[model samples]
Target: MYPKLPSLMDTRIPTFLKNFNLQAFEVVGYSAINAKYQADFCHVSVKDAVMKGGGRRVHGWALWEFESHIVGNFHSIWERPDGTFVDVTPPKVGTKVIFAPDASLKITDDGTHQTLYQNRTSDPGLPYIDPLGNAANHPQWMLENSNPSLIEYCKSLGWNNASMA
Candidate 1:
C-alpha cells in the first residue's frame, strides 16, 4: 500500500506558509504546448497556454523533493475560465502538487522562483529549519553544490540566492 500524502493544511507545514492558504491541485500531465523540454518550462508553457487563449496563468508554489526533503517550489499553472486548475508542467514526483497561490507574483523573462522546505525524514541528525534564513531560504549546500549556470539563472531572476536546481 502507498503511504499517505500530507495535505496543504497539514500541521507540519512551516509557519511562513500558514498564512498563505496554500491549496493542492492534481497534475494534469504534460502540457499540449510545443516546448522543447516541458518539464523544465512551466512558466513559459503556462504563458504559451494563455497566449493561445487556453487558460490564464496562476503563480504559486508546487511541492517538490530535494535531497530527501519536501520543498515547495515556486511554480505556475493554467487556470481555466471555468475555475479549474491544471498543472501545465509535469511535477518532479507524484501525480499532485501542493500549491500556495500568490496572484501578485508574475512570471518574468528570467526563470526565477521561490522555494520552501520541510524535513520529513526520521533522521534526527537533520532537524527542520523554518524561514531557512540563509538568503532566499536556500541552504548553503544547495548553492555550493548545484550547477553554476542554474545558480546564475536564479540570480538573474532576483532570488538573491540559488535554489530549485
Candidate 2:
C-alpha cells in the first residue's frame, strides 16, 4: 500500500529579506510537468561530527551526508533572521501539499518565480534537516509494469524474458 498526503502550510515570507542568501543547488516541489503530480523537497540529516585524522591535527573537513527527498511528506524550512529562508522545495505546487510550516506563501511579481536565499559557493552553509517521509505519497511502481528504459537496458545483457540476473 502507498502513502497519501495530508496538507500544505506556506508561511508568509516577505521578499526584501530574502535579498542576501544562497539558493540551494537543487530545490524541489510538486510538479507533473515531466511526470506524475507530486510534492518533493530537498533536505539533509547530520550525524555526530566526526574528526578525520591522527594526532592533534585533523585533516578531513567536516563530513556530511548529502541526499535528496523526492517527497518528504512534510516539509519545514527554517527562516533567516530577515524572514528569508532557503526554499527547501521549488515553487511549483503541482496539485496538493503537506506541511509548509511557514504560513500562506507570498507570490512574487514574476509568475513561477520566487526569491530564494543564496550565498556564493565558497560560503559554507548547509541545511541540517530532520526530514519527514511518507511512502504513500510517493510514486507507485509495479514489477509487471516496470519502466521500459530499465527493461531495455537489462535486455541488452542478453538475459531472456522472465529471467533477471
Taking all chains together, each candidate's TM-score versus the true structure is: 0.51, 0.19
Local error of candidate 1 at residue 45 (angstroms)? 0.5
**Clash pairs detected, candidate 1:** none
Model 1 residue 108 lDDT?
A: 30
**Model 1 residue 8 distance off true place after TM-score fit, in angstroms:** 5.0
Most accurate candidate by lDDT: 1
The 0-to-1 C-alpha lDDT of every candidate, in the order given, reads 0.50, 0.24
Instruction: Write one digit per residue (lDDT tens) for candidate 2, span 14-72.
Output: 11113213122222233222121112322210000111111121111111112221222
TM-score, cand. 2:
0.19
Candidate 1: regions farther than 4 A off:
1-9, 14-16, 19-37, 65-70, 109-165
Lowest summed-lDDT stretch of 10 residues in model 1?
Answer: 133-142
